[model samples]
Target: MSLDALTFRPATLADTDAVVALVESAYRGDSGRRGWTTESDLLDGRRTGADEIHAVLAKPQNMILLAELDDGSGPRLLACAHIAIEDGAGYFGMFSVDPGLQNGGIGKRVLAQAERVVREQWQTPTMRMTVINVREELIQYYVRRGYLRTGRFKPFPYGDARFGLPKRDDLSFEVLEKSL
Candidate 1:
């Protein structure tokens, strides 16, 4: 499907499973390896879970944005991202695009829509995210999208199985931000 054919909508509780699957396929395991955004080499196990997504959905200031394409068939969940109002800025995370459809410009659209959701809907002035510092390619992708590296860092949770099991010891996150 063309980029114009994609649909953007806020995810509800009913969309939990599809959202989790889409995220896992894009970031972890063998499924994630099919996509350039995969962090399979850096981490292992689940990318996200129902409880976490449910928490995000339950919050009044947070939402999971889904990007779908209805190509004669029923709508297919192609991509998704988590947006939350942290302090005064929009925090973006849990971004995922179907591994099979990566590099097809779907991710770019989802990100743009996410920024719009925060800027227009929430009246937020800035968008921010944390990226695994080792993922240079992924970091560069966001840089090209206008995100600036803040030089600030957050230590990756080593004991948090919910995030993932790190394959290396030097894992950490770098902050990135953009004005809306």
Candidate 2:
């Protein structure tokens, strides 16, 4: 799909299932393998579930920004990301683009929009996100987009199936930040 044809909107509780499916497809399981963002090699199980999306939507300061394409049938979901304002900064996470649509500049556009919303709407000075430390290629992708590796790390929730099951023992998250 063309970037010019996409529309951005804040997701509601009604979008929980679709959002979860999109995220899982982009980050975990065999479906994710079709995209460059897949973590299948390092992790196993769901990237996100309906309950998580519902919780994010229920929060006042959180939003799941969705990118949709109106392809005549209806507005089809193409990408999504979770953004929340906390501690005077925007926290970005759960980013995913349609697996088949990866590497087509859609993610870049969605990220830029999220930053704009955080800066203009939330008046935040910085945007922050955490990536699995082992995802070197993913980290570099964000670096090229102006995100700096902060070297601040957090241990992955190994016992929490909500995050995912680690295929290997070495798993942690490194924080990345950018001035908005």
Candidate 3:
């Protein structure tokens, strides 16, 4: 969908299935191959499930921001962001845009909205996320969004495919942060 035909809103429990599907399409499957954010090579399983989405909503300190198409055909989940409050800052993650709709302004606008929600609603001063270090393109996207590389690295949890199956053995995450 076009950016002009979209809207943003806080996701509710009812949106779990759609959101999970959108995210999977954006990252872990054949559809994801059409966009730059595809984790297809690195992972070959479902990106997320109902239980996880429901758990995010269950967290008092977390929220998932969703983007919806506004064609009145009803809200079609397009992009999403996961944010959690901790140590007085909002930790951002689990973001993905529908593969076919990437390279448009949809993901950017959704991220801007996520930042706004973190600051205005949670009163957080900073937003942070961990990106797999080898994802240079995605890292640059975050940099362009005003986040700075912190040079902090964390081991990629391999045995636990909860994140995704690794495409390379050297995978790990680097922390990036931005003040709100």
Give the whole-model CA lDDT for all candidates, comma-separated.
0.93, 0.93, 0.86
Best by TM-score: 1
Clashing pairs in 1: none
Q: Tell me each candidate's RMSD, in Å, in order.
A: 0.7, 0.9, 1.4
**lDDT tens digits, residue span 24-101, model 3:** 888887888999998888767667888889999998979888888867766678789998897778898889888888
TM-score of the candidate numbered 3?
Answer: 0.94
TM-score of 2: 0.97
Score every model by TM-score.
0.98, 0.97, 0.94
Poorest 10 consecutive residues of model 1 by lDDT? 1-10
Off by over 4 Å in 1: none
lDDT-wise, the better of 2 and 3 is 2
Which regions of candidate 3 fall more than 4 Å away from where they truly are?
1-5
Q: For model 1, how does the per-residue alpha-carbon lDDT over 1-180 read when each residue is reduced to its tens digit?
A: 687889999999999999998999999888899999899998897889999999999999899999999988799999999998997899999999999999999989999999999999999999999999999998999999999999999999999999998999998999999998
**Which digits, one per residue and each the tens of the lDDT, describe model 2 over residues 5-94?**
899999988888899889989998888999999999988877888889888989988999999999889999999999999777899999
Q: Top lDDT: which candidate number?
A: 1
